[model samples]
Target: MTEPKAIVSDLESFVAIAKQVIADTRDKKAIPGKLKPYLEQLIRHREWLDERFRQPNPDAFAVYTLHQEPDDSLLIMSAVFLPGQGTPVHDHAVWGLYGVMENQTEDTRYERIDDRSRPDYAELRVVDRRLVRQGEVMISYPPDQDIHRVVNTSDKPTLEIHVYGADLSKLRRRVYDPQTGRVKVIQARVPVN
Candidate 1:
């Protein structure tokens, strides 16, 4: 069996690298493609990524804010999900990158089939369901690839890191009811600790 790798003790460098990448991407005024490389780079930080999963919080999902641009240009956070815990089908208004840091998760991607002008009416179809493992990354942008749900299927707690084009906590996002085909506007909660 291969030996276990040492855990990373310093997260500062990793955060700095992410910040630089986001800044560069913004400077170029590019989205969608620019963040892919950044996500790949983050997934390569195995030790650092694993460090976020060390302690499992039994409360609501554990979320740690790593960095956020003053202008809301970018936001990076580390999220920990306990077993059987997950999110509702939701959409982020801006671009996003999700990277698995520990264990495994089920990511269900959806495609909207109705018009957005009628807020009370909406429809969605499952386009894909993926098993995202450590070192894997997923990208999503509004209008095309933004609606999805993430669930921690492992018995133990799972950790993941996310980078958003805007400060998610301040954005007005949407959550869809798969059965009723209704959409509701909601604000993302700010990460704690």
Candidate 2:
């Protein structure tokens, strides 16, 4: 396991680095893709993540905010998913990166195949499905490549690092039900802490 001190240092260092990258870029939406390599570097070596952010919720997947800018410019969170737990198909309205920090996870990307002219309705097709092992990353930018569902198919628990351009809890996101062609816009899930 990685040393605790170093882990904290790395996290702080990453926040600073991410801020700089965002400031230097003209197109803020490109931040996630630009920071992908840096994020991979942070989680490459699987180690004991902070206990505070690893606590599980028996009823639902858990999310804990590790860092957030006062201006709501950046939000960093840790998510824990128990075996067979996952999220409803949804989209983040902002650009961000999600990295697998512990065990593997199944990420299924969906593409809206319908014209979207119908109100409160949407038809989606699976565009990609893969087992994202530890250290792998997922990226999203609004209105394009922004939809996915993540599940912990493995028997053990899974931990993921999520960094978003906005305070996700404040943004309203769209959730899709492919079977019913239903679409609902709702607030993002609030973090436990």
Candidate 3:
């Protein structure tokens, strides 16, 4: 599947293709894996991303909604990372696919090492660190294996695409502190969907 069967050169085309893929997958948990190849094709093409989403914010990083399914069953988004801006360790609590569109970024994945006895605290250990360059994608699976942080290692702005099984901005997800071993719930405010 290195070459696209149909050219997904625009947002609408990509969304249509994605919605079909989502519908074809019988197991809801497999949506991210099923969507990865199309997203990779989209990443390699780069024509589907908007020009406005390629710019970085001056004082902070920015996240923009590309599209969301009508039933709120899917969300596609773009994120612009300013130089040196990085996300804290967090979990999406749902399936997701992250594809790098322009430039590159770094991802740090952590593994929870503690027993699940407490709700407000977790002991974590660094499990993986890698550079996800342009045309690359990463997956976040819920319940486990979704804890990670992303950083813009480049000196200029970098753009990345995000596709989640649900509207992540409205969900109360978990945020972690490695230093204090603390956990907090946060609902992110995002650009209009």
Worst-scoring 10-residue span by lDDT in model 3: 184-193
What are the per-residue Cα lDDT tens digits for candidate 3 across 77-180? 88998889888889888888899888899999999989969999999999999999998889878777789988898897788889988887688788889889
Ten contiguous residues with the weakest lDDT in model 1: 1-10
Residue-level lDDT of model 1, residues 6-79, one tens digit each, is 32233565455545656656433345455555565566666664455445577667777777778887777888
Over 11-90, each residue of candidate 2 has an lDDT whose tens digit, in order, gives 77778878877887788778888777777777764453578889989999999988899988889888999999898888
Write the candidate numbers in order of decreasing TM-score: 3, 2, 1
User: Model 3 scores what on Cα lDDT?
Assistant: 0.82
User: Of the pair 2 and 3, which is ahead by TM-score?
Assistant: 3
Looking at model 1, the pairs that clash are none
In order, how many clashes per candidate?
A: 0, 0, 0
